[model samples]
Target chain A: MTYTITQISIFAENRPGRLAAIAEALESENINILAFSIAEASGFGVIRALVDDPERAFKKLSSLGYVVSTTEVIGIKMHDRPGGLREISRMLGDAGINIEYAYAYTGRPNAVLIIRVDHVDEAINAILSKGGQLIQRTELA
Target chain B: MKYLDPRIEEMPRTEIEALQFKLLKTLVYRLYSFSDFYRSRMKEHNVHPDDIRSLDDIVKLPFMYKKDLRDNYPDGMFIGGQEDLVRYHVSSGTTGKPTVVGYTHRDLENWAISVARGLTSIGLGRRDVLQVSYGYGLFTGGLGLHYGAERMGATVVPASVGNTERQIELIQDLRVTAIACTPSYMLHLSEVAEKMGVSFERDTRLRTAVLGAEPWSEKMRARIEGSTGIKAYDIYGTSELSGPLFTECSEQNGIHIWGDLAYVEVIDPETGERLGPGEKGELVITMLQKEALPMMRYRIGDITSFEDSVCGCGRSHVRISRIQGRVDDMLIIRGINVFPSQIEHALMSVPELGEHFQIVVDRKGALDTMLVRVELKSAQLFSDKLDDLIRLKNKVAHQLRNNLNVAVDVELVSPETLTRFEGKAKRVIDRRVL
Candidate 1:
């Protein structure tokens, strides 16, 4: 079963050294950033990260006065070769599952793609039908 | 013109001084006879009522500070008994315990008259509909403007703060001709009006604005006038001196203090030496006719200068410039004095920045660090790139350094993030232990 993986998002002022400060705070807490993305708005930036410890990272980041929230995302494991991401994207696209945002990291044998989509259940079914392995939440921990 | 009270408004300077002397003599004698606080204070200085023969001799009397009011607390300095009192108002006391002020029936009447005079000077009349937007109740702004507008025969809306949507609707529905509120709130109103598609120039009959209760600049006056299409005038007074008492006339030069009701003097804050005309210093005032609580030589802690010459409005009363800043609000950064108003003036010059800002002062080891967090205007916020934002931040910091003569850290934030105040806005947050 492709269970939902929780990802943490932090709202921060769009300024120099703000991201470094957040990174320093998470590093101090021993939280490893598995994947991360930065979304820039008009005068602020949102840092969305998939960390090894979502609960710990959320708590540590929030205590430092950063507006933070958690969203459920599905992670997929595909072959590390080219077309790994294309295969998963084609399956989700064929099923009409919209990917709101996505980020990826490649390991030696496999690549993990973190996908935030509108229809989570349909995307999971599409990935399963295409023989794509779903990364479980407990595997990161 | 249309004087609220022609006799006092038309009185000559010499006659006003004589009247002030007579009232000072009576007030000092009464204080010596009744209130132990004033009696001991006067005796400590070895001054008697008879010593005050002329207005110049008023300098010999002791000066009272805001701390004195706090030390006296609930009722130590009030002369009359409980039976003689008609009303009481209090300071906001955001810093500490509230200082109390009482008013007799006559005191209330005179306060109404003082405000009425100011309202009339700015061309408010019976035919005008005035929406009193200052907070009412314990704070003097609401009731002070209320009574004055009523006395001037203007239809009073009594809209005492914080219903923004309804306030705009009232302006449109009732055809409000004038408004009295803090200058910042007026800017907020204008912003809200624009969003709601209510243009004051086309949709409302608002013609006059009497802004006071906080220090504002001529730049702000020009901004308000340009946006709302109303003549923005400054009104000045403190709760201890009877709410808002003086206002700018049609000429819009400076505030015309009523000479017959209150005597004004500017003294060097450090030396207590009276400064000449056009010299800025601490403003000290003596109420000539307050019955319940007559304030004599009260140091109001505001920094301003006096204009000696007669105003173009044909009034001989001494006009004081807009309050620069309070002695208490002055920040000494790296041994240099800086007022928030100066910083505001600098920031307002830049069109990309919004009106809301916060001054955060912290001590980093042995050095004092000032961080100014200002909001970007909505249009600027949308169009600014990362490099442009950094350049804007540095530009603002450069401007602040030039104006304050002290380096400051400027942090540009998103629009509508910094807090907007409906009442007296608290802009400075000092975190230094000292």
Candidate 2:
């Protein structure tokens, strides 16, 4: 399956209105956000977002004075069965690629896996070579 | 480089004294309007605004201490009325109580300008991208640096702090040029960068770093600069006194104080008399041009010194040495003054211990007990050989007693036992109740 791909940009802060400015820029560019997560510390915050038009979103966010960068995260469609993640993790683990963090949500048809791995290029290549279907975030968004 | 008062920022010795005299007059006069505390204190000293005609007359005004701010609480001492205040930033409530400081729009602008000036001093320009890692909200460092970056016409990457994985990715992808954060945080970032096999120094576009808000020794500076492969400059300021109060020029000898906008004085903490050049004492500040939240003869409590010699970098403004310690945080244990920074410096000098450590002060009966809990990165610490651990403990104790003039018990905790602070870690815990 060809994954419905959407770009994810992680936003960080060194000042106020930084995240808001990033979101505003994306909205101004008419980029649709599927999901977002933020973690803050004393003087900064890390913002992660799933958005439509990943490449343009990256360029627009950067132009608007944001530390925007794209990460190739896979939206994997899996059965809502138990050990669905275990199979994926085992496959990746067997391939010697460690999963750093993963986000998941249930869809009407299937469960979505937002997987972040140690080596994005290697994991994506391995999964694709093995005929694994990578779903796009737009379908969910 | 247009200065509101060009003479002070780029002035000869003869002119600075005269400028100090004129500004002191204006400062004293200004205090009468909004600073009720200073106004009353000046009256109690039998002094009026007009009476302060010279730099020597600065003594006529009573000393303003941090306790004064703490005692006043929210808005008691502000010279400008509450209506003028655009925002208020409260100190981290680690001390007895957090002292709230108000900032007018002008004050905020001044903060941005000051930090921008600091950035410029370190060769930052419009073409550079500044990745600020200081946290925003209430704390002045992040917002203050943010405005300065924007003021300089530079692209600001407001990465507030943490989540190093993304931080590294952003650094590489965006090609950020400069970074501003605590030196410890920078070191931590460097450590993580290595583990990720990210050649931060070679690959990333970072050229300069501005580190402050916490006391760091010269040894630490060398380490930071060498490891990060960036020119690390020391920035000095406080929320109450305004952030980025001083900036180090290329010479890196001493930080140049903004003598025109803010009058700085070094005084003996005990005698309250102004000290001569090169003598260490507590730093006091007086806002000359500040309209909102102007402070008159405010004691910053930071121990420092001033040098009048022309800087090697050729900036004529008076230079302030690095802050030694805070008077309020000075722990007088068993009749000796001990600063937590001193212990931290000594501990940090030891390569075996990590950057994180804690000073726990608990009391037993009438006497106070000071215990230093340090963490080592080695998984099997104090194993196989107990002598190394004992030697480490003795070395820490000796340094504490010798440098801080206070005796403290040193304990080597496991790797993850000692507390790790996100910002301005609490170094002391006074268990005394009276």
Candidate 3:
């Protein structure tokens, strides 16, 4: 089985306190936000976050009236050095897999890269064949 | 065209005048003796009831302005008291005092009869189910069409305004054959229907529409009728003559004004001289049979030519051309009359807004959208928080809607964002393409 992580995306108006409301709901449920990024378009923003409990976060945010969706993304553990992104990107590019969007976070020893790709299964096989390490959901906990 | 009452509708031009002369003589005699408002108006113009010898002698009477309605307002212009009145419809007045129209039971009957005849001219009858989509309350459009459709024995759906998706469903589930609404609303409904994957031709059995209350183009008619495969007829009337009084017959050439109910004339707005048939000018009408609020030669500010010739549909009623434009600056938004002064009046009540505001009106997907971009007093008026801005914008928009009775989009801009004194009607930027 492939290692796929669930990322929660929240549709929010690009206004102050919107992010805080979403965060407040997650906090109330004791759901830890592992990694988060804000993608802004027009007068609104899409807030993508990786949480300790995807299902719990989805319910809490929805009940609180925040529009949220869960998407499966590949989190790759990479070298914390300068060529970490280039190496991972070039490996997928050589295999003809297109990365739609990506973001990264750093912890001790290594950086974790979260990427959304069209051909998820094929990209995972290519990266695994190249000896790259994929981050598991439990590893963050 | 079919006739609901063939005796009156299909009568010869001479007989139409005979009916008009009989009603006019009775109306003049009643007003001269009973109504101080009409008696005084006639005396000032040196005309008596005896002066009105024939239909053409209507020129001897003085013209009544919209100001007459305003000056009298609520009850002053009315012929009888509340005991004699059955209903009242109020319209927006330019000078803040709303013009109120009162109707007795007989007056309502005549209005419904007029609508019945109009519906019949357009080929809608008892078997057809009509949806009166015009607003229902104090404004006249909704109730006027409702009564007329009911009188004609058409099962009427009093689906007055808004709830586009639900109205679309009713059109399908109820098998609504005809609808009465503004031309803009028809376009909006069509656009919404398309979004819901509902085709008027396929999903619904809508065959006709009676659209009016605001000026629309023949091109707009072609656009609506051509796309939706529904026959769109132009309905014409102002609140002065009891809301929607007449509509275009099957000929679709001009809106037929029933000769028995009202006498029609086109006059040079400047000189007050009556123009011959086919001459474009202001429309003046005398409501012959109205009892509660009998209006004689009320100057309706709409600009159009008068057609006295017979319509191809075989009706001998006088027809008016499609309203070219208005001599007044009244703006009709989604069938409701909106005045620019009313916009300023709404803005004055809001403390957060500055004096300078620009009104941008545009047609989006066939529906008219009015965007009011007003300047905030200062950035310090509210924080940059999205909630605060939206709340304040909604407040301004809510104030506008409450005042004007039409939904509008409000944009909050920084002070000095609006340009000053560009031209006449600088406060408005109407980008609507006809």
Candidate 4:
């Protein structure tokens, strides 16, 4: 199995200025947001971000009284061209792996697609054994 | 360290009891001889004032209730005529007709003395400036604390509840050192002050607050003290007892009920049998010196207990624990007695939970069920993992079970969903009768 990436999920109320506050906190600590996604829940939302420094970001945000924690998610490096995305998608699909949620950000030469799947170890095997590229945590920094 | 009335306040317990019995005997004779209401109540109970030889024999007297005041209406139970009355304060009843309480010169003086002792206990003195933020008019709070603050030689600012900006102005301009208001009002004032860019710790001179009139938990007190950076002491009394009186001293353990002015007892609400010290039960009070409105063993209906041990403040008065919910708010959930205040006390202990909560009780099949729906604090205190959220729910349930001795289900709701009350917060919805 390949390696897993750490993502910070902030439990925030669905109100104005909350996202700004989170971004301001991250900026104050000089933590760069590599990639992030926001998901809406019942009257609350989660802002999952892949920052340059997950450990520092977690401590800073939590210290500012924001509900924050880190979770292990898989970031797959896929082809930059169209239909190149099919290479990793088909490998996981044919292997009977389910993609719970996925979002992509442009990396140099290729795109690093962050996908949280139900089965972590199996998804890592399905991708890595098939010669798929896995982005290291240092590569994001 | 100085007492408002040291002679009686610092007396020994035996001496305090002697004074109480003497005052009780005098009050009973006055009630039986002057008022028609007490004369018939004693006759109806077949008990005479002559039978009361000792303090413990107070049980021989019939218990008075809020109902008695309502039934008597205006001046029916008063000991003196309108010519003898100096002031009148009517309590607005939520259920029935309002209760009119008249106070003669002596009655008003005793009321102020009660407040004077209470303010002194909270570490306030003539050097401090007091803002009476309670509502004036028919409400006893404003005028009661007003007179008390004057008697204690403090500069008085009759703010009287409203105009938040002006209240803040007075607090800053007058350099008010203390305030007497309801607990909710204190929270509201702090909020308003924050909006006006005023800091309680830096801008204002408020060092202490005597908050009461509403059922507030210790956690709430901690929140107020934490937020305002002031010592928040609990002052407890009803308009029926002559406004806000008997506050927690600097120790902030319990309220010091002056043994000379009134005698307090904890009685079983169901059986009227007196419970020993430290046992939780309904509180019954007898006004030993009230002139215009002579109340004898008035059933207060507030559930609490008292300790006869002298307070650390050096007063020999009995101090009762903060008022747990009123008797009417008690619910028998799963055959276990529960009060909403107990649930509030349990929930407020967790800083993550908001002050608002709703208790919903219903019967599922043949078994009874209870559910508590609470919101998160507005600023934050949330969780991302389902397991972490579940752990919080379990912890809250455990606290509730420990306090109420009944199984309860907890649900974490979103902020701004629960209703916020300006006066009294109604937190229970029992749907079991259907």
Best by lDDT: 3
User: Candidate 1 residues B1-434, lDDT tens each?
Assistant: 38878787777878877887888888889888988988899999999888988889999999998778868787788878889998999763322346688999988888888888888988888999999998788778889999988988999999988788899999989999999987767877888889999999999999899988765688888888998898998988888887888888888888888887888999999999999999999999999888877798999889999996877777778999988877777665543346677788889988888788999987664246899998766532232123455677789999888666568998877556678888989999988653
Q: Which stretches of candidate 2 lie over 4 Å from their true place?
A: A1-141, B1-8, B93-96, B330-358, B361-434
For model 4, residues B1-434, the per-residue Cα lDDT tens digits are 47887897799999989999999999888888988889999999999999899999999999998778868786688877899998988764433246688889998999999999889877789999999998787777889899998988888999997798999999999999999887767877898899999998999899899887666688878888999998998887877877677888888989999888889999999999999989999999988888888778988788999998888888888999999856777665532346686788889888878788999987664245899988766546444555566677789889887766568988766555578889989888877542
Clashing pairs in 3: none
Model 2's DockQ score: 0.01
Q: Better model by TM-score, 2 or 4?
A: 4
Report clash pairs, candidate 1: none
lDDT (CA) for every model shown? 0.82, 0.70, 0.85, 0.82
Query: What shift in Å separates residue B175 of candidate 3 from its native position after superposition?
Result: 2.2
Please give, for residues B1-434, the per-residue lDDT of candidate 3 as tens digits: 37998888778999889889999999999989988888999999999999889989988989998888878777888887899998989887764567789999999999999999999999999889999999999999999999999999999999999999999999999999999999999999998999999999998999999999987898898899898999999999989899999999888999999888899999999999999988999999999899999899999889999888888998888899999988877787777777788888889788877788888888887777888877666423232234455677788889887777789988765455468775664777778876
i-RMSD values for every candidate model: 8.8, 17.4, 13.0, 4.9
User: What's the iRMSD of model 3?
Assistant: 13.0
CA lDDT, candidate 4, residue A106: 80
Error of 4 at B214 (Å): 0.6
lDDT score, candidate 4, position B68: 84
C-alpha TM-score for every candidate: 0.63, 0.58, 0.72, 0.59
What DockQ was computed for model 3?
0.02
Off by over 4 Å in 4: A1-141, B329-434
Error of 4 at B400 (Å): 34
DockQ of each: 0.10, 0.01, 0.02, 0.11
Question: Second chain of candidate 4: TM-score?
Answer: 0.77
Task: Arrange candidates, best DockQ first.
Answer: 4, 1, 3, 2
Between candidates 2 and 4, the one scoring higher on DockQ is 4
Superposed by TM-score, candidate 3 places the C-alpha of residue B325 at a distance from the truth, in angstroms, of: 0.9
